[model samples]
Target: MVETVVILGAGWAGLPLAHKLLKYTLPEAKDGLKVVLVSPNSHFYWNVAAVRGVIPDAIPDEQLFLPIEPAFAQYSSENFEFVLGKAEHLDPEKNTIELVKNDGTQRSLSYDQLVIATGSHIRSNLPFKPIGTHEETLAALHSLQKQIDVARSIVVAGGGPTGVETAGELAAAYGGEKDITLIVAGDHVLQASHILPSVSQVVEKDLQKLGVKLIRNTQVKEAQTDNAKRENDVAVAQTRTLILSNGSTLTTDLYLPLFGVQVNTGFVPPSLLDSAGNLALDKTMRVTGTKNIWGIGDVGNLEAKQLTVTDAQIIHLSSALPTVLTGDGGQVVKEYKPSSRKMIFISMGKKYATGQIGEWRLWGWITAYVKGRLLFVDTAEGYVGGKHLRHASM
Candidate 1:
């Protein structure tokens, strides 16, 4: 008997897990196992460097997007299937899921086990994550770059890593030629509760050195694009009128909002989700109240949404899943332990960076070398090629 395992979403978490199971677990299963991966996009987007990707000519399209289907060429057809669609419905009681294909067709799949890794999307329509299909994401990236190329003044909202990195990229490319302003809602940027106050101070200095204008303690309440304005009967480029929280209005040639993420759990059942709509998960990463279903990555509420945490969850589940599937009573299922220490690195353009691990702050040069220079694009292909499985095994 062949037991099918359906994994949803092929982003940072789902893609790697599929590769691991196909390489390490499928061959070892007593009952034959098959892995089915479902995603809305046909390509794997390396969105870690999306901040710099919006900057013109910083990175090529080939390096940023990889075809997802070709990566699984090593696996046999009997063991793996990649479906290009979005998960529209999930019924755990029947162990079946319904997906709406890109062509507007529907398909129903039954699974012995399910893994939810739909991840999250940026609040605004940006290329930070897979907004839709591969072509749609590519179009968004190119459109934003073209806008940045001609915009004389740009306003970036939400003082997090994306906003900071974007401001840095603009400053590095255009210097004082263009006016780039970053609006921070709180007193400082990188204002996550876990981050130390000192880290924000250091980041502030880095942005200032890059000639990024910082607007502190302010928020963008509303932004309206005015495209009909003309000067001397000649049409001008569209501009954005921003209404600030401080009762002030500022207009700019371009506006970029990089903040907040809405988890992609709309298709999940309400009973399995928390009040915030994130999937409720146990310590073992299994969906709460369900045995064969598991939730991970940004869709689950076990830990903060970060790539390191997502990677840790993938490593743990990949090791523990085989025991559950094969009914190996002798082997124990290891519970996932969330990391308490704060670890993050923010790259300010291509030259400077800032990071903190626990209570220690990393030097700018060290961060730049490790993350700022390339944004980990070099290792992105490994995730798709099943090479990450070897690294995890060791």
Candidate 2:
């Protein structure tokens, strides 16, 4: 029997891993291994630029979704496959999983090896991510954009990367016209947590220049949206309410919260995950005590959750996996250590950004040219075979 390697969730981690595995392992015939990518979404989205999508006219919904089919077309059908489904349950003892399709039909897949890369999802609905088909995602983006378009005042909760980028993008696009307030739970934005000190300084400075009101050392206590919505049982709270933990309140037309990303690891057993659903991972990205499985990307308890870091994992896996699968395939013999140098890029709209690689800090213009401009949406197309969908706006 030709052993199959099953990958769940085609997010930042799963998508690249799937493509590279097909490119490196299957085509080269790594012991006749078969690879299958299972995702609920039809498109392998570029989440790196998802924050820009909230701006009224910044990023079109069409540009984000890349057809996964074209990216791995070179691999023969004999060795590669894609499944549109959600993993409902995993029976690790039996090495089989129950998957639910779009129609609510269930199917069983038995894998010789399983890779769980089902990255994180923001709890609040603010157009930071699309949950379903391309049409559904398009509608979601439009709705969120509509909220932003009409709001006279906006309150953004969470000082993390997503909230910072959202505030910058919105401020850059509609600074003078709208009132934008950024509420950070820490004294300084970015908090330089898992990033460089210089990056936080530059990003906060640029945001201040953009006229963003920074409310430091405060956390959101309540959020109430007039146009509240619920989709797929996920509450699109807009993270509104404008209530602060300090007992102050500001009534805003729109409230966007960017923290609290829920890991799609409900299928994972409780014993394997922390209270927050984060998996305890070994040096080799394997779930602790699991012999035939590996966890990657934000799914693991890594400090940095950038796209570049996720890609680095794929590079390591493309080299390490072959040895493990060919050998005992029991204990993960391959080792991977995340780079000690703190690397990050915080884009402040298309004209400016702040990024640091190790001790090296990049200027705003250089950061803008590298990743701030278009938020790397252009470069992302290259990763998935550069397939341009005509239906997507130019």
- Choose the strongest candidate by TM-score: 1
lDDT per residue as tens, model 1, 206-315: 88988889998999999999873454453344698999999999999988899888899999999999999999998899999998899989999989998767768888
> What do the candidate models score in CA lDDT, each in turn?
0.87, 0.76
Candidate 2 lDDT over 162-243, as tens digits, reads 8998889889888689888899988888775566776888888899999899999998887666565555664433434567
Candidate 2 lDDT for residue 159: 88
Worst 10 residues of 1 by lDDT: 228-237
- TM, every model: 0.95, 0.90
Model 1: residues >4 Å from true position, as ranges?
A: 228-237, 330-332, 389-394
**What is the alpha-carbon RMSD of candidate 1 to the true structure?**
2.7
